[model samples]
Target: MATNAQLGADDDYIVVRNPSKLADLLTARNVDPEVVTKYLHIIRGDAKDCYTVGKTLYGINLEIADMVVSDVGGSTVVKPNRLRPTLDDPTICQDVVSNIPNSLKRIELLFKATPRTRRKPYIVVISTTGISNHGRDIAVAMDKKAMEGILLREIQTGGRGASVIRGFTAVRPSFLTDGKPVGAQKIRAAVEEEGKVAKSAIGYTISRGDVGAWIYEELVEDNAAGELKYVN
Candidate 1:
């Protein structure tokens, strides 16, 4: 999702990205400088105090966040992205899950710290499309290792360990195409149950922009994608 869009609009965000191209990134996203000051808290790795624009970093930071999003997968940890996965290299199926042990604890604390209010925050993630045996019948189990890793993040994060921070939703899309948004209504979304997201059998592929629209509908427009509890 674009930072200038409703994805980051009027919301306090912990923006973590390659800080070297910070200006170009914002320009590409069409975000104004003022918008950066109004809502974003960038985690500038290494360049000490170069961009300490936000006041808070650790304390109560995760707690107040409106959403906990994880876009990383198995390929996230693999270095030198030029090469494909090899059968010999183990731990390829769960790079993100394995590295997020500390983050899991932090997520739990965020859930626990949730205020006694009507609205609750959500944890959303991008999982692979082959998890429920619905998409790409040809891809072998070994090839879908990244998908497996991503699905693990969704399921594990939805468990009692996190304990009611908000609803959790996982979008397991097939090959992502780049183009104009296909619109969320065009998506044949998988049925969401208590703690499960059934795979969509009919849909073979979805555009990245469509995925963003789907997320906006789920998170912003209240067409939520999972079990929810709106307390009074």
Candidate 2:
């Protein structure tokens, strides 16, 4: 993430994760985590509140850059310039707090920070099928359906902030498989404003790596086919 090393660019980069685990996260992306210290700005715990935008602004004078890519597993409730928690509890208002996965709650940062951003960050969310009145239902992946429901409901809510987000694309890929990169070329993908959701042609499966690469192409490479410019 540092200065767009592999992709070739000089930009201030800030990626936060536990120091011990940071290496693995970067390594998964084919980055040499060992040398990251030379480029990345490491955030030690408690020094900065990366959650609440109000508090984080005072702490870091932050900017989420030109784009915010959210790969969160579950959907979140994005408040519309509206009320939020007093103590940063994402699981606060849900009737089924136990049902809300940690992944879903964690995305609270994505929703909260993006709206307040002066830079109109192009937001990309990896969603799943079965989000009511949308993609076909995936009976086996119960978790996916649940998250999709929550996401769609909240986004459709009257005062939700996430709806106001610009350049937002919710990629609803089918059952995600790991271990090998099948590549997006092997699968069929359809894009539409509302006519043909990607989930419609999701097929049986897609690789996580391919999804990531697709994102890299759309944002970093700036594919002429699609839009949004992040310039890695």
Candidate 3:
């Protein structure tokens, strides 16, 4: 495996020829920045941190390029460019599960172990079951993690295979004015369910409306590749 020191310059850019070389160069034991950067390079981006290099089969951005690198004993720890994960827009279901540890307690443990950066490190759990009608996946893991006082920031229900029904009807509620109204009722139900899921997932109380900003910070605006802007 080719290490970072072995990398060659390609017209002002550093290139790592071998893909597997990155794993060897980076220690998987913890959040290493050097490993993350090498991982980013292996994944490839335009001018480093300009845009995510890979995508999942679902069109989700898989490799987030923007990262904060911390030098740790000849290694680097790479994390989301920003401390938080975004979730405001409702359209982009951030897939942060891969970045998280296996269990819910593992998340809390990891957060406590890692050193704090400029921003507070809060964990946002996105439900991968992909059940939108069940409400946003962000809430479940978020709530579980927040039980320790971490804050559940934002919730979104529904995804590619998810539904957005508003509410449930008890015995049709009068079949007057056409059944088309039922459709609207379902939509409302879905929206309301999303809210409920968000609340349920948080497991703790947050300042009202703050979840929106937290979601936007970690998810949408903090583009991984966008970090190149500061590199010069």
State which candidate has the highest lDDT.
1
Number of the top-ranking candidate, with TM-score as the measure: 1
Checking candidate 2 for backbone clashes, the offending pairs are none
List model 3 lDDT by residue over 24-121, tens digit each: 64454354765465444343322112122112100121111122211001112334765444444222212322122122223234344443211211
Better of 2 and 3 by TM-score: 2
Which residue ranges in model 1 land beyond 4 Å of their true spot?
1-11, 15-17, 45-64, 74-101, 104-121, 133-167, 192-201, 220-232
lDDT per model, in order?
0.46, 0.44, 0.24
Rank order (by lDDT, best first): 1, 2, 3
Model 3 lDDT at residue 164? 15
lDDT (Cα, 0-100) at 155 in candidate 3: 15
TM-score of each: 0.56, 0.53, 0.18
lDDT of 1 at 223: 27
